[model samples]
Target: MTRTTVTARPAEPSVVARLSALDRWLAVWILLAMALGLGLGRAVPGLNDVLAKVEIGGISLPIAVGLLIMMYPVLAKVRYDRLDAVTSDKKLLVSSLVINWLVGPAVMFALAWLFLPDLPEYRTGLIIVGLARCIAMVIIWNDLACGDREAAAVLVALNSVFQVLAFGLLGWFYLDLLPGRLGLGDGQHLDVPMAKIALNVVVFLGIPLIAGFLTRRIGERRMGRDAYEAKFLPRIGPWALHGLLFTIVVLFALQGKTITSQPLDVARIALPLLVYFALMWFGTFALGKVIGLAYDRTATLAFTAAGNNFELAIAVAIATFGVTSGQALSGVVGPLIEVPVLVGLVYVSLAWRRKFAVRGRA
Candidate 1:
């Protein structure tokens, strides 16, 4: 006789259905959050200052908590158990890892230097954004595009691990050492310490990955996989969304004065970003097709490569650079540009799916 597992029953309108709609409406919420954050910052006067004052290691305590909350739920949902399975598709995995870690950063670096050569601060900020790959929102984008969700989860987990290991060293090379050698406008001399990078990884990625893995394993063991995926996952899913909204509010609140004062500055920061997103998405999509990857695998690679982990980038900007620094400002502007742009890409992906209609596994 075979042992059977008990699972949660679905409601007439399941939690997944309700939450699924949230991703579609995320841009609206993000805009609203930005407005509310900016409004509160402008109206309250000292509120942002007060928030900035409560800090340790140059990181605001409240913002740190919000960032962690934003990250953990997303990381937890990544099918780490399925990570090895992704390796079976070596071409897809290798292409994604190489593009995300290498080509992505190089493009952003050149674009920043090309577009904002005179503005070192914004240049550095853009480079930092480029270095940080997507960990959360790509999941939504992947779902919207009807890509391989399992593949997306596996790539996300891999990127998260790689970022923790490479971000600091990359930052040093691109923003600091390489610039001096190449003579890119005094090299910016940005001081991004490996220790700081390592600390952030431990705090933002490590804690969450460990916690997520433990919780998932224990939950599945106690309640069974079906129940855990259905009941438990949905329950915790909203944490990332809520935390994201709260974080956007806090970020804009902190920079409301500067943002309102220098509107063109925001545009300058956004310029390279828009180009970066388009290039990454289309480049990867075309490459996927050229390599004869299936629609699902191609979509997965495109979305994964296109998205940026702005939450981690923002936190790092504030901590490593200063709350009021241009680096921090660029980080703040990332989501403002990213949400609308990526949402647009979702539609484009849908259209492409209809147009080409190619099919093959990576």
Candidate 2:
């Protein structure tokens, strides 16, 4: 088994290789969005004033756009009928669901409480974020993780279905630990805002999801697997990135004032997030392996378990804690570090693939 570290990768990939490596650097794009937002927000607070308010009944358009963009590729990948083919791979489906919804959230809560006792609201925010589950990016992470993509698709569908039914319940249940400040502003029930959140999901996760599924089925029915995958799925990746970028820009712009006001708190929030990421990545990865999943499925479990929707986190934060509270702050913090952190993890997953493959083969 080739148990190599990511450092063993060439100090630089070739230009063509680097061109091919665009997805690997999604973190850089997200960071650049952060910088652009900071510049715009600081230079013209009016810019934030204008951009932040492109809202409807209170929901932000950019976030809606992001939701559509995030789910399109995911829904595109979903093959309602493909399960007939991969039903043989039940282990992948079962492990992904267990790790993603159950184990992942629990690990996040533990990590948050243990490492971030000083920031209770944000710590609880982490728990809230974890409970939100995966939407679109899990596909990118699974692809990067070299996971069984079909299995990942199935799980995404399952997650979207389950999140809506359970979001309100989980939101109220998880954040029940933290007291609400209804007199000061925030809502009494964290999940109550999910009615708005559910509309966003239907607009975001539901519409594109249905469209993507239809498109995938038609494309596959007409052009067959190789052509559809080669033609459509790859294109969807860029769209997803653009959507995420748009979301990232607006997020940083809206949150820039908060981030700047108490800059040192960035470290305090980020530290526990770092700890959270490590715990999640390894914990899920190890759990998958111990349960006897292979390299690909194991990687998917690891990534899905580690990634959070943050959409729900942000929404609930606004509803429960207002835009500037520590909880809301932590919700925004999830994305700032998410792409970069997960990119590092993709490499780790790839590096460890050989060793895990050997074990699987054994």
Candidate 3:
């Protein structure tokens, strides 16, 4: 006799739904976390020394373990099946990809070269920082913006796979094109040749990515996807956050004097990041509306356009040039500015929904 197979039910609406994606408002939580972190770093300036020195096998724990915790959930959520769908939309994807990798990096390079003081090492680090396409955290922004989660998933996975290969050339271009802006032949700039950039990519991106994928597979086979996210994954976030907190504390402690000294330079780097985010947010929205995308699809495109994977920025920055270095420091500063900015953009998306009512209707 042949037996028929039964499909399991999807999870019922629970607190997650009740929270109304906006009400759950992870952006607020992230902002609050950063606020607490800043307060702690300042009030307890000495805490940074404690969290800064985590090493195993001559490598730091942030790349080794902290990054694994950060990326696992994204891997767990991957639906390779969705990517193969014949009805898949390409307009949104193409627009987002072009803007993110092409427009975004080029704009960053030009703007940084224009304004950033002549510090070659700093310039190279900044360029490497810009070359990377975001991977891990942008999804949260997508969800908050009420985006097309499926599309977001596909593109994020696709970008993560591609960024590993592209980062080297992009990193080189930032330095080579922005000559004199980076103070060529300076001690700091001189060290960041091509080979080091490649090595840093493998250490930060390759290792955590492969490990996260494997571990995500193991967890799924064991507990099922729903159970794994609700149970194991939430537990991991706090620990990862704790690791981040520790790292921040150490970073602040190490730079406690410098932060006081270089507040002006901090302002310069921050201005570009802020503008980059705003441009990406609005630029994507305008294109989506022009294309007459559906509400979810437009939101997905805008989120992909607006937000970035600053987590990778931090890890790569630290591994490549030491966390205390200015480039690394600027990379760390990204999320400090990104979280609040994206939350505000989510609100802006909601406000502008009416402009593209066709996209919003569905």
Each model's Cα RMSD: 5.6, 5.7, 6.8
Rank all candidate structures by their lDDT, best first, as comma-separated numbers.
Answer: 1, 2, 3
Give the whole-model CA lDDT for all candidates, comma-separated: 0.76, 0.70, 0.58
Could you tell me which 10 consecutive residues in candidate 3 have the lowest summed lDDT? 1-10
Candidate 1 structure quality by residue, lDDT tens digits, 9-38: 112222224446666677688789889988
Which TM-score value belongs to model 1?
Answer: 0.81
True lDDT of residue 124, candidate 1 = 83
Model 1: residue 314 alpha-carbon error in angstroms: 4.3
Q: Model 2 Cα displacement at 301 (Å)?
A: 1.4
Candidate 1 whole-model C-alpha lDDT, 0 to 1: 0.76
Model 1 deviation from the true structure expressed as Cα RMSD, one decimal place = 5.6
lDDT per residue as tens, model 3, 171-250: 55555544545554323222334444344445545565566567667888899888877797666544534433344344
Compared with the true structure, model 3 gives a TM-score of: 0.69
Q: Mark the regions of model 2 whose C-alpha exceeds 4 Å error after superposition.
A: 1-21, 77-80, 85-90, 177-194, 221-226, 231-237, 357-362
lDDT winner? 1
